[model samples]
Target chain A: MSSITSSKKHPLFWVLLLIITVVTLFPIYWISVTSLKSPVEVISSRPTMLPQAPTLENYVSVVKSGFFRNMFNSLLVAVSATLLSLTLSTLASYALVRHNFPYRGNSLFLVWVLVVKILPPVVLAIPLYSVFIKMGLLNSRLGLIFVYQVYTLPYCIWMIFGFLKALPETFEEAAMIDGAGRFYILTRIVLPLARTGIIATSIFSVIAAWDEFLFALLFIRTPSLQTLPLVIVNYIGEYETLWGELMGIGLLTTLPVLFFSSYVYKYYTQGFSVSLK
Target chain B: MTQNKYQKSCFFYLILLPAVLVMLWLTIYPVLNVFTLSFFKYNYLSDEKVFVGLGNYIKLLKENLFMEAFRNTLVFSVLATAGEVILGIALALLFYGHFRGKKSFMIIAIFPMMVSSMVICAVWKTLYHYDIGLINFLLRETGAQPVGWLIDQSKALFSVVIIDVWQWTPFAFIMMQAAMGSIPEEIFEAAQIDGASYMKTVFSITMPILSDQIMLLIMLRTIDTFKLFGKVYALTQGGPGNSTETLSYYIYREGFSYFNLGKASTASIFVLLVVAGISFIYIGKILKKD
Candidate 1:
């Protein structure tokens, strides 16, 4: 992969790249500008390329209207889901990679997990909603956390399994030769070495749980219990035509994932490429 | 050694037990529940339950709304997946040559995919508004009649597809770029030395080599685009006479808004079958390759 580097250049390449970048990034730029604009400019007939009177009024309103509470709800669900999924899947992937189960090798188990990952959320949502209602989990944060495992756990197993598969088994073997227990070998030898993979896996889990809309929309009814995506939807309805504040909340919803994606930029790409292979 | 091996196997089952049970409980139990629920006439609001025995499926097959939702979902998935893959290949090809600031350009280009789909729809919703939208404003400046991008029945579905293409094409581009990057430089250099033109290299060399990756990406995008909900919810809510009503939205409304569990479960099973079919092809291909 590293052997290929084409130095061929043309003015056409530069122009095309410029156009593509502009087209791709323009919406984000426009939304940021709208968030900073006064309401008068937001609904103006002629769209301004830049904000005329840049103000924090929209962002201020968003915060003053208890945006942080919803933010906390989103964070709590996403974090809890990530932690639980990571621990469970780490153990699961370890077992699959290192040991045999009844009548099959680990590939079947891996494929089973992948199937869960690929299943449509709506297919799960209906049954889960009814089940949650019966169990008194409706509109509860704990309910959302449990349901998010349907989304987070499978992917966690898939990626972490790949990481563990690629890792040389010698370290674990040496520890085993010294009579280290499986749990000790895992915690003392495996987890630290697989730190980057764990982070990459968790980022996806957090993002999936955080940005989930369908389950959050169906499962949570109370406004205070809603996540960020639900709050953004509610803002769309309550502040109908209040484009400025709506865009403000929209930006708030997007910025964290953007920062997280960029923070793990290297591993994010690597992890995806590895999983594809 | 035998005792140790047996002990190790015990440890394996012990370690695997929690995730296995949880996944099975979450996945298998709910799937089975939905499957069985499809056979009964159940409504969440009225606490009514009765045996339907293919009644919901028969009714849905005759329901125009369900048919329309199915048709819209199929159309959206095909168009959006094709558009994203084609545009992604084009974008990747355009930026194949090394240049200054390429890394930053890629970072900026992939920003759309990193943002939430709901947020992207919100941004596009403003741009697609009838009168004051920036798109219409530009049209007016050009002396063209303004288009109702999302408000017209014939245009609403396509408009939603455009937003999807905008958001997800970057995924295809990133995957293809990585695949293209892995090809050794000598292959291209060899083709160039053999007097092959750039177009020939792309068509004859680059494409054939990248075909597997392209196929994988197409399958992934196809599966994802089939679950079209967030954009429709945030943008049009399947309005303009239900032109943008996808299967996911239809299922959501039936299950949540009306509390018709039977019909919703029926539709959900239809979706599950289609998705399982698509994924089976993908998984079969991967397993065969290995």
Candidate 2:
């Protein structure tokens, strides 16, 4: 506090910080402008700080096509994966924390889930493709949902487990003394008590599922089933003309995520900080 | 209604049973399955599975493209990881002094990171467009020619590396900032009184104190970077003649595009070894600390 108070009197530091902030943010700002610019303005040899005329043409084109369908696909996979992973990871972590069981040394089996995070998706692609093919889940939204669980489940467990450890055991015991069943206690007591952690976990899961690309690219091939991230890239060109629409779609895809986080950023991103440390 | 203690324990294990099974089948089974396929030459559509005994491994070792991918991955990972960590530290330092705009500035700084990697890549891909990119536009104002951003074989990997830095530097920043806040300000004050300059204080006092967190960031970043599928898929397509082909992209093409399970599996094992080796070190540290 003292250091901060003394340092603030310096004009140079504030100016330098402002410059750094602009450098850090220039790309996102530029993209936003590009997405809003007219076709001619975007492709013009000279760059314009402001668009010649802002147009929603790219946004309209994307929406009129399968873009909504793609967003829907992303929605389906992300929600299903978050719900499934949360349920399983919560139950598993509950069992670990509340019960004494045989083979408990493998309490570390949950630790192995982090292994999936490290295992490259490419390695999983070949065999998982076969597995899903036999199960008839390829190109299905459920397939990517199932795959995303593999990525997010470890996080869910480790995180929820941290919250459970921090919670008082007396509440669960009190419920047990009242003749409440384990299932009832879990649903009513543990779940309710862990609300902040669960919500944080879910938000993180949603972002992960939304942003996921490689699996969606491989697993979902149909235009309707493709996720937003996949479709946004499809409209872009390697040698190209219009930069504006590309920027617009890019901004569109990221807008909801930023809003959701700012709304609950304290709970969600902060949880990541705790779990990571 | 008197259940034995052992029976209650059994019930708990039973509750855990389905989850364990699913995770095993989904994660572990595929890993082992990839292992089995690595030694075999299974055609994409064929019913026959021929075991070729280290044949694919031999083929990869002899292939120039495989070596190039291995080299490219290491270079990209090292540079990208280092860039994010260093940049993260610098940004964290920027926020050390109290400023009215620090909070808004941070949110904006992390904006690139919060968006989906695919979306960010789409934006950056346009910015890197040789003809119309702002980067080139800026360069031209100084009388310089447009730099080859993504199109040229030589600069393609560099462009991808730059995107990774932009997206992930915030992660490093966030982690380090959290760590920095925890370091008792008094400790920093004592170093200041000991006649340390700002740079000396950070290099000696701040960095050494935050080394563990920095290493943790490096580990986390490495695992994610090793997965490097999004940007490459979005940007290069392993192209300008496969100049930017990475291991994950190679495996993806082999497995999904070509349906060449054998080589894909081999490549998968290669990636697994690299990641697993790094993880073992971290796991050991975590366990030892416990």
Candidate 3:
């Protein structure tokens, strides 16, 4: 439609794009290199752009210090929380979209859920701590899995509810006309259709639970129960700088999240756009 | 069809019952407990639960550290939220058209957002180290004196803000980009055919269409940044002095570190009110839009 502007692309645009790309990736690149550097090269007076002598010594030591166990702990908590939230919220979101309630509208329920979701995790920590202690849930992975529903459940409900709302009522009505019950219609029709939203919700829940630090730090006093974030922060508190090992574990911890995010990048963006709608 | 509406209601409620109960116990109960705790001079360590009836609130409001933390949270959130949304929009605009390597570039840009805050801070903390740090190394090479990135209290909050911007700008960018991408290319083409310049097109056409997503992004980032804890915990630990103290960090210290449950509860209530107020404004805007 336009020839004049399209005819000549400015060099400055390319320059800016190049700068943006580099600035975007430099820290990740630097951390990756730092993680691979030998101990001598790590604390050297001069910064090394590339590792002088690369070594796995840092990763080895990090693993030796219950790092894998911590990673496993994070995995257990995040997966459990995601699964639990998704299961409950899927059923709840379905009922929310398809049926009418006696007292309040479904949208109001969503608002209530969003409000709870937004409460700062720190505010919940002290009370939850005392409760968990009485319930014998402190320093336990199961406790974190349960408590993390505070974030994950509300998110799943709101997000999946958005997805369910956008689906046509005709298909479900047709199923009902055939004498299909609500449970059968939901499992066969709604769940299959909302798979993308379900996947996106799962990814979001896992990320929230994985990145959670304040609650884990407060509730899980047992070192063995510490999650990856806890272990990384423990590196800061217990030892010297140890930037090499720190970066090594840091890089490892981030890889799974990066891959998962990139996988659901499309749905993640779509979910945001849908929520705004 | 013969089944009563009551049974239908029961079925729906039964399905929702588990999540509702869990959320109620987790959210409402804890919140009310925190509210009740705010009125007492409770210390978990000493097992003291003397009723103070707003004494904790008075004490916290009068505490210098609490005031500093509140101010720091406001400054950090305002700056960080503004920087992220603005820069995010700019970046989204810059990459408006099809370009080489655009897909990979988008992914790379958001990598920081996907990574943990503590990890990012760990990397940045090393970079901000006084000596033998990459930033200082770069400064010395350019014959410029190395700046105290974290050590100097005055610059510390700004440093943390920069990190927040770096880590979160992609979030705003992605949301904006997704919104911008939805507008038909024909709209932009029509604007171009009408002899509109790039700046004119962006301000008049692009931004107006993307404003809803922009509002959403601002609300999300503002609430998230106001609850600043992981970065402070990882990087500054509320700092060389009270320089980097945030409301969340302040609450953490009072509740966990000091075990002064009443002061922490009071501080938590303050944070809750402020956050709820900000969210209330945002939700009202959303409801109006809908």
DockQ of each: 0.55, 0.57, 0.56
In order, the B-chain TM-scores come to 0.96, 0.94, 0.95
Q: Tens digit of lDDT per residue, candidate 3, span B152-174?
A: 99999999999999998988888
Query: Model 3: how many Å of interface RMSD?
Result: 3.0
Residues B1-290, model 1: lDDT tens digits? 89987888999998888998888778888889999999999998998999989999999999999999999999999999999999989888877757788777777777888898778878898899897899999999999999999999999999988999999888788777778877888898988788788788889999999998888888888888988898888888899898999999998999989999988999999988888888997888866754
> What DockQ would candidate 1 receive versus the native complex?
0.55
Q: What's the C-alpha lDDT at position B51 in model 1?
A: 94
Which regions of candidate 1 deviate over 4 angstroms? A1-8, A263-265, A268-277
True contacts kept of each: 0.61, 0.61, 0.56
In model 3, the runs with Cα more than 4 Å from the true position are A1-8, A268-277, B288-290
Clashing pairs in 1: none
Number of clashes recorded per candidate:
0, 2, 0
Q: Which candidate is the best by DockQ?
A: 2
Cα lDDT for residue A223, model 1?
Answer: 83
Name the runs in model 2 displaced over 4 angstroms.
Answer: A1-9, A237-239, A263-277, B46-48
Q: Supply the TM-score for candidate 3.
A: 0.96
| Pairs in steric clash, model 3 | none
Worst 10 residues of 3 chain A by lDDT: A1-10
